[model samples]
Each structure stands twice: as C-alpha cells, then as structure tokens.
Target: MTLFAVDIGGTKIAAGRVTEQGDLDGPVLTTTTPATQGPEAVLDAVAALVRQLDDRGVTAAGVSSAGVIDSSTGTVLGSTTSISGWAGTPLSHHLSQAIGCPVFALGDGHAFALGEAVYGAARSATSLLVLAVGTGVGGSYVRDRKTLTGSHWAGGHFGHLAVPQAEGLLCDCGKVGHLEAIGSGPGMLRWYYRHGGDPRLLDARELFTTADADVTAAHAIDMGAAAVGTAAGGLVNAFDPDVVVIAGGLSQAGPRWEQPLRASFTRTLIPALSGTPLIISETDAWLVLRGAAFYAQTRKDIA
Candidate 1:
C-alpha cells in the first residue's frame, strides 16, 4: 500500500510519498508553517499539504512533529514557543479526519532516531542514541527499532539536560544551564557575540563559516561542540547504546565542530563505554520521512 510521510517543524511543513520499502518516493513538497495562527490553522495547513500529495492509493500517513507527542493518541502534550498554540493538539485525529486516511504521529526526535536505526547511519546497530543539533538539540534512544519514550513522552529531550558549559545562560524553556543554551546553533552564535566576536557575523551558519579565520568564532564553535559531546558521553555511560548518531544541521558544520565534540565525548566516557562508535547522519529529510512511514505501517491497528 502507498503511505504518506509528513514532518512538521516551526519553520516548515513537508510531505512526500513513502514507498513500501520504507524509502521516500520522488521529491518532497514543502511550505511554510503558519505557526502563529494557532493549532487549528496549523493542522489545516498540514491537511492541505497532505491533500496535495494524496493519490487514491494512500492508506495512511505518518507524521513526525516537533513537540512532546503521545503517539498512541496522536496528541501534542507540550511544545515550545516556536509554534504558538501547538500544545494539546490532536494531530492524528485531526489530520485523519481531514484527509480520510489513518494518521499516526510521533515526536520528531523519536522518529529521527527510528529512521537512523532502521536505514541511516546506525542501521547496523542493535541499539543507539541520537543527538540532533540544529536550531536546538533533540535526541532519542532506540532499541530494536523501538524508541524509549518516557512516561510523559518527553524522552530524548537532551537539550534540557543541565551542563556546566551553559551555566549562567538562560534556556528557551526558562531553565538555566541547559544543554540547548550552549550547544544549539543559536546558542553558539550567542556565545560568539557575548565573547566579543565580530558583530558582522550573523546567524550560526555564518558564524560556523567564519570560524576558519576568526579565533573567537572558532572558540564558540568548539565550546558548543564540546558541550554536546560532554552530554553524549554521559548519556552513553547511562544507556550503553552500541552506537551514538549525530544528526541535524550542526552535524554538517564540518570537522571544526566535530573534532572538539569527539574529544570531549571521548574524555567524558568511562572505561567500559570508551569504545562506543559515534556516527554522523548522511541522509537528510528522507530519514524522518522513512521513519514516519515505518510508524504508520507498524501501527496499522489505529487505522
């Protein structure tokens, strides 16, 4: 049966067809998310996008969304300010009703982890931990193709973990000393500016590119990467996953960020966990899409 995949983020809404082999078929369709227009508007926008991609052959659609999602109920339990009025949204039910197809929804972190475990960098591993460094840090732990979602569906929110590097900085969640405050792309840029880096360097992408020549930018990048590595090391000690995968936008920042990150991760691990492999994701949006399709296929009862 033909399946559909959707990934909903604060900045974009993307949809595509998923082949039976759990691969994305053809090009992905995209549009801006109406994040500030409230939950209903956002749901409607997603439904519209799905309609554009729907062929009569579609039996279900799987969604990978940003939030603390309860996949069973397809509901958003909590969300960040990036998407206004996104919390408590009945995503699966709403989208299913709108498109006349079964809809399965899960947190983007969980979906991303599952994607990597099944088809991406960690495909060979029996268990793995994934840290996605982008606008913010997202993470998940997966074993045997299933994610370890916490009781409140908040598992793998590694960005919220407290880290020494973030100690005086304020996190977006109103918490102090959280990983995201120091490891995220924005966090690195903020660090650069706070440390008297050139003001002309705007955004994390620019800051990363400028790191080649500017000492301040390089320091900021290294510090952020180190913070991420430190957190990963601690998590590896706890979960003892066979592999740790790094995904998301910052993973593409090149060796400047990765070398320090590896150094910190290796330094933090205990003797037993010292040999864990750290893999970087090579696929992009298709990874999430493939995971979403897998979710929909496995949860056919909901249909």
Candidate 2:
C-alpha cells in the first residue's frame, strides 16, 4: 500500500510518497509556501501537487500543518498571521474536495512525535516528548503509542509555558516571558541583540558561529542553552516521559549548545527523572514529513 504525505510549514510545503514501513518512495516534492497568499492559494498549491501524483496513480493524502488543527474535523483552527487566510479554515474537507481523496490532518509537532515513536529516536518508548525548536518551539507528548490531544487539542503546547525572564521578551503569540520568547532561535537572537550583541548576527547559525570565536556571542549561546535546559527539565518532571527527542535546525549547533543544555537540565531535574535519556534526532529536516507518512500508513482507512 502507498500513502501520500504533505508537510506544510511557514516557509515551505513538502510532499512525499511512502510505504507501510516508513520508507519514502520516489523523490520528495518541494515548493515555497506562500505566506502572503490566502488559504485558497495554499489549497490550490496542494491540490496541484496532488494532481501531479494522481496522474502517477497516487490517491490518499495526509497533511501535517504548522498550526492549531482540529484533527477530528480536519480544520486549521489558527495559524500565524504571516500565512494569510488560514484561521478557522476547514482544510481537510477543502483538500478532500479539491484533490478528490480522503484526507487526514495532524499538527506538525504531533506528526513528528508519531514519526519518532514509530520509526526514529523513540521507537522503543511508549511515553515520549518530542521538541522541534527552530523558528519557534513545537512540542508533542505521546503516551502508550498514542498522541495526546487534550481538551481543545492543546495538550502539548510546551512553548507557551511561561519562562522566568524579564518582562520585555516578546513571543510570536504576543506574550512576554514565554518559552518561545527565550529559547526559540529568533527569541535567542532577539535576546542577544537586547543584551548589546551585534544585530548583524541575525540568526541562530550566525550567532553560534560568532560564539565559537567571540566571548559575547558565547555568552548568548550559554544563556539560550540554559533557558532551553530549564524548560526541558520542567517537561521531564511534569510528563516523566521515557525519552525526550530534540529535532530542529537549532539543535544542529552540536556541543556548542548541547553541553550547557544538558548541564542546565541536570541541575533542574529531580534526581529520579534526571537519568531519563535525551536523544537528538539526526534527520531533523525530514522527521515531520516521515511522521506524516507514518500517520497516513497507519490510518489508511481515514485516507
């Protein structure tokens, strides 16, 4: 059996075909996501891709979107303002009608957890927490091999957890002192700039590179790691997950960030759970896409 998967993000849309064993078939298709265009345009792009696959004998589709999704009805409840006309849209129904196939929709974070639990870092674990921290922080909690979607489908919103920081750090959600305001890549850069660091180091990569040779940049990296570690410690204590998998672009900084991150986590976690293993995924970019494919393969009936 074959399953079609789509991963929709703020900047790109990725589609792939996969088998039951989580192996992708054929080349993955990529296209720039039109943040300025409305939902119609986004749907049109997805439909166009599906049509291309349909000509090649593909049918069912699953979508992993970077927004609050009502999985029960396949609706995108809310999305970043940058992606115009995405709020409260019935994405599943629209896509189903547009592409002439059954559609299953899941949040990107939740899809990532599903992917990891089925085939990646946490495959042997029954309970796990997965964090994908890049432009923003997205989290998912999986218990007994099932994704946890709490009341209003907000169970794994770890990024919204308030952080202990000064009042001026702004979050994408318009809040101050949230985890994303301090630990996310953009947030770290913002904090660096606020602390008199050069604004030329506009992203996490540049900041980490500078930190490798500059004292001030190293200080910024340490601060970011500390904040992330504190947050991870809290998550371990709260969920007592068997495994914590970090997967995202920022995680690629290697030891420059991991040492401090582990140190801070060890300092904050209770002794009992401190020993829980934390693994960083090697294939960060495709984890979400693979997870979406896994979800589709398992739910073929829905597809």
Candidate 3:
C-alpha cells in the first residue's frame, strides 16, 4: 500500500507518496513555508500537498513537524518562532477533515528516529538515540523499538540541555546556555559572527567547506563538534543507548565535524560502554519524511 507523508519544517513543506517498504514513488512536492504564516496557513499547505497524493489514491497521511505534538489528539501544542499560531491547534483533526482520511501527527525528531530504526543506520539496534542537527538541534529516544513520547508528548527536547560554557549564549527558546545555543547550524554560525568571524558569505555548508581549507573555519567546526560530541557523550552515559545516530544538514560536514564528534563521544563514554558505536546518517536530510511514511504504514488502522 502507498501512504502519503508530509514533512513540515521551518522553511519548507515536503510531501511524497511512499510504499509500505518506505520507498518513495515519485518526486517530492515542495513549497516554501512562509515565515509569517500562522498555523492555519501551515495546515492549508499540508492539506494541499496531501490532496495531490490523495488524487493519486493515497489515503493515509503521516506528518512530521518541528514542534511539540500531541500525537494522541493530533494537535500541535507549540512551535518555534518559524511557525506561529500553532499552539493548541488540532493539526490532525484539521488535516483529516481537509483530506477526508486518517492522519497522524508526530514530532519531527521522533519520526526521524523511527525512520532510521526501520530503514536507515539504526535498523539493527533495539535501543537508539537519533539527533538531527539542522537549523536547530532535535532528538528522540527509541527503546525496545518504541519511540518514547513522555507525558505531554514533549520528551525529546534535548537541545535545551545546559551548555558548560558561560550562561550568556541565548537560544531561540528564550533561554541561555542551552545545547542548541552553540551546537546547532544556526547557532554555530551565530557564534562565529559573535566572535568576530565573518560568515556573511557562508551558509552552514560553506562554513564546513571552508573549515577544510582555513584555520579559522576549522576552529569553528571543532567548537561546534566539541559541543555536539560532549552532549552526545553525556547523553550516552546517562541513557546507555545501544546506538546513537546523527542526522540532519550538518552531518554533511563529513570528517570536518564527524571525527571530532566521535573523538569527543569516545572521551565522554563511560569505560564500560566505550565499545558503543555512533553512526552518522548516509542520507540525513530525507530521513524524517521516510520515517513519517513508515509510521503511516505501521498504523494500519489509520488507513
């Protein structure tokens, strides 16, 4: 059976037709998510994309989004500044009503972890942690092959962990010294700019590219890697996950960040768990959408 999946991000909305085995059947349709748009607009955008797939006979829909989602009720409890008016919105009910089909809402990080566990690097592991480091850092923990959505469905907000650095770094969540303040792609770039570094000509990709050939860029990459690795190590020690998967745009830095990240993780792992492995995603950017599709397939009652 084919399921329709929608991945909603701060900047874009992507939709595709996915088979039961998580194979995407056609080119994904995408549209820019306007910064000023409210939750209604976001819902409309998702509905339009799902309708396109529905026209092709797709019935079940799964949505992965960057916000606190109440999966039990299909509502978006809250979101970052990128998506306004999402708080208290009944996203699942709206989408289902709009498309005339069952719809499931999932946190983007949880969906990404599910995708990796089912089809990507973490497939063999029963307990895993998946971290996506993009515009912001997001994480999800899977144990016994089940995604853990804590009370209030806000379990994976790991990026809010306090950083060891001084308490001055501001996070978009209106907090200071959070992990995302120094480790996320935007956070890293912002840190560089604040430290008298010029990143005007660089996005996260170019910054990592420059890191390979420039000393200053390398330092920036190292700092970012250290922050990420340190956090991963602490998480590993605390949770003792069998595997940790890194996914998202920053994973594209290749060895520029991966080596340092691994080194930091190794330095931080408890002696007993030093043998644990960290797997970097091969196809980081698309994992969330694939996972959403996987979710749609497994929840057969939704179809």
The number of the candidate with the highest TM-score is 1
Tens-place lDDT digits, model 2, residues 70-181:
8888898877655787878798899888877678888888888788777886798988888877777877888875689787766677777776742467788887878788
State the lDDT of candidate 1 residue by residue for 1-303, as single tens digits. Answer: 878999999999989999778877767899899999999988988888877875657888889998899998999999768799899899999898998888999999988888888888779899999999999999799998899999999999999998888999999999899999989999998999999998887799998778779999999988899999999999999999999999999998789899999999999999998999998889576788888888888888445
Residue 215 in candidate 3, Cα distance off native in Å: 3.2
Give residue 91's error in model 2 in angstroms: 0.7
Q: How badly does each model clash, as a count of residue pairs?
A: 0, 0, 0
**Deviation from native of the Cα of residue 245 in model 1, angstroms:** 0.4
**What value of lDDT does candidate 3 attain over all alpha carbons?**
0.80
Model 3, span 1-303: residue lDDT tens: 777888988889999888777888887889988647788888888888766764466768888987888888878887767787777888888888898778888888888888888888778898998888877888888886568889888888878887673158998888888888878887777777777677563676667766656666667677777788888888888888989988887877788789888988898888998988888888745767888877766675544
Candidate 1 regions exceeding 4 Å error are 301-303
User: What's model 1's TM-score?
Assistant: 0.97
lDDT of each: 0.89, 0.79, 0.80
Positional deviation of residue 57's Cα in model 1 after best superposition, in angstroms:
2.3
Query: What CA root-mean-square deviation does each model show from the true structure?
Result: 1.2, 1.8, 2.0
Better candidate by lDDT, 1 or 2: 1
| Sequence-dependent TM-score of model 3 | 0.93
Ranking by TM-score: 1, 2, 3
How do the predictions measure up, each by TM-score?
A: 0.97, 0.94, 0.93
